[model samples]
Target: MASRARHGGQAIDGRDLKGKAVISGLGLTEMGRIYGHSGGWFAAEAIRLAIDDAGLEKTDIDGLLVNQGMTPLPGMGGVDLQNQLGLTNLRLLSSMNVGGATAGIMVQYAALAVSHGMANHVLCVFADAPLREGRGGGAAYGGGGQQPQPRGMRGLYTAFGMFGVNARYAMAASRHMGMYGTTNDHFGAIAVAQRGWAAMNPLAQQREAMTLEDYHASRWVAEPLHLFDCCLVSNGGVAVIVSSAEGARDRKQPPVYIWGMGQGHPGDLNRAGWDIETQTGAPLSKERAFSMAGIEIDDIDVCQLYDCYTYTVLVTLEDYGFCAKGEGGPFVADGKLGPGGSLPTNTGGGQLSGYYMWGMTPLAEGVIQARGQGGDRQASKHDVVLVSGNGGILDHHCTLVLSPHPA
Candidate 1:
């Protein structure tokens, strides 16, 4: 198997792992508030489900990748999980903390490992117990009540009362509104559309339909962002099984081939002074992934983008070339993201209305859509999907182009 080359017209290194890997199985816990469950417990259960879904036994999992985020349960890292799961043939173990981009990065590593024969089957899992820590369940700011203080320059940001992820996103939204004439109504359209999708999702956290009026009436979390614009912080676990293309051929379910994968970190707002409002690392990552996949943006049939906030989704749509920059507001205004629209985005409702499994939710939903397992919310075209992950305050990004067959 040859390595997939990098995008951006770069020289082929003959070491990039692109289409050689495929996602054979995906599993998730009952999303939303699951009381009295540790992150480790949820992770273990999700791993079991993924393995079974892949038509394999526990022994088949030789690699494990764990993403416990900033506040992991007591014992949920890679080594701890390897011990907890009682796996005897574990050959690869690692942990990731790229914020929401962790899941996509894990898949990149899994593809590399499986393609190189380092591991036959790799399990990527993520879980968090913000509710178990006596924190405000599903709240985004202050680590859901952990109130973790920032370090270094972020400490300066904290002292000036610029704390919390939502605050930063709010600032970005305000800038976009000022620069491009984006309005609260434009942002509201995203909330309404995602909630509409959530209504059809059985495992979504907030399933009640939301209207533009509801979005305007909702309390403001920040100046430009309302309660509906933010994501739901729920307790749950999501896991995916990655294997070599050859290994996936014998799986019980259809394989969603990893056509392309890439990661980019242009800059971090707190430390790098990057422009958060108008720019993101998504374009860089998208270019690389699409280049390796040998497909243009128009080839995408569905998109499962990381929507930690509504603005995030809008900006990403532009950055990924789905629409021109500054046109995202209008592009998503007319129910384009809802069912029977030009583009069906976040079909499982995404983080805004779906369970916020950090980045895992989008990845799982992408696999489900490509496998044609999305029952009610399934898109009309399911051959190709684009799944993206954003981490930190729009600091890091990872993109994956997946398809039912190798492109």
Candidate 2:
């Protein structure tokens, strides 16, 4: 789909950091509904697995970065990870939050650190314990809504903020429909296609094949956003090991090179004419990242765009120039993102069908695909992979261009 306006895969002259670093190891704990542990436990265990996967011991890691997600609890997978893992003398250590974008940003930070001599090996991790034993997935995200009721007419200004993310995304999706004649079917196409991808994934939570009828029959979470529009809640962790390209050579696992990285932060969502419904931070992040990768949109063989909701995939495709604006509805409805499609996107089912680890959901799948380890769902073309993360109410965005070959 992006082949229409494609550029040759040539490195553009700029501050290039292509192939400077690589992800040497990846560790994922059992995901989805396997309760009885804290987020900290998951993070620590993932780090251990990642270190072992890289053929390195705990002492080899000198940097630690954590993404605890938005509104994290008192001990949500960070703050105590280093001490719990018994990792000490860390040259780089920090806890950051860009909402769902944190996982990508953490890798960027780790890559920079390892390349610049701040640290030799860096660990990036994200985890969550949102699923309680007795409660449903909705309970983790406020089944009744996260805000308190308004008492007076003066409280009307807080109307939009009173609900949780379901309402917020519904507004964004509704705006697309009003402006571009988009339909529920367009969003349903995304859900159905990703579910199809999930059916081939062993770690996927919802592997059952779904059809257009099933998507339409699902209950509505908010207006046009259906039950399948939202991501799944999981109790697990994902960790990655970032090392210099030279350091990654001959590692235990195939090295997944970090060819390019970029981050974009929209100043204010309420600004006049802010493109909240029509655009996203992907466009702003794309140029810097692609140039560093020495490639264009056509060179990308696979994509792992964040899919906290079905609308997220549609808008991100439009913003990343994969398809024309307002045509995202039709672009997906044509069945272009599923298996055997022109563009193999979200090959691991994404957050929709994959276990939700915030940005790590897409990032982990990118690593797997780049290493040619996706097994049954692996894309035929594996030269270049595109990964993106969107945070806030589309306020922050980050992109990483990864490849099995060096840049």
Candidate 1 Cα misplacement greater than 4 A, ranges: 1-10, 13-18, 74-77, 132-135, 138-159, 269-274
Worst lDDT run of 10 residues, candidate 1, spans 138-147
Q: Runs in model 2 with CA error above 4 Å? A: 1-15, 70-79, 143-162, 269-271
Please write out the lDDT profile of model 1 over residues 1-407, one tens digit for every residue.
22445579766633255579999988889877788888888898899889888898898899988999544645534777888789878888888889999999999999989999999999999987666555665343443212266677646765677657778899998988887888988889988888888888999999987889999999988789898889888888999999999988867989999988888788754444556567888877876687778778889999999999999999999988888889889888898888778899999999999998999989999999999989999897988799999998888899988988865
Alpha-carbon local distance difference test for all models = 0.85, 0.85
Candidate 1 lDDT at 378 equals: 87
Residue 163 error for model 1, in Å?
Answer: 2.4
Write down the TM-score of every candidate. Answer: 0.92, 0.93
lDDT tens per residue, model 2, 117-220: 88999999987888888989887874334336654653553564546778878888999999999998999989988998999998899999989889989998
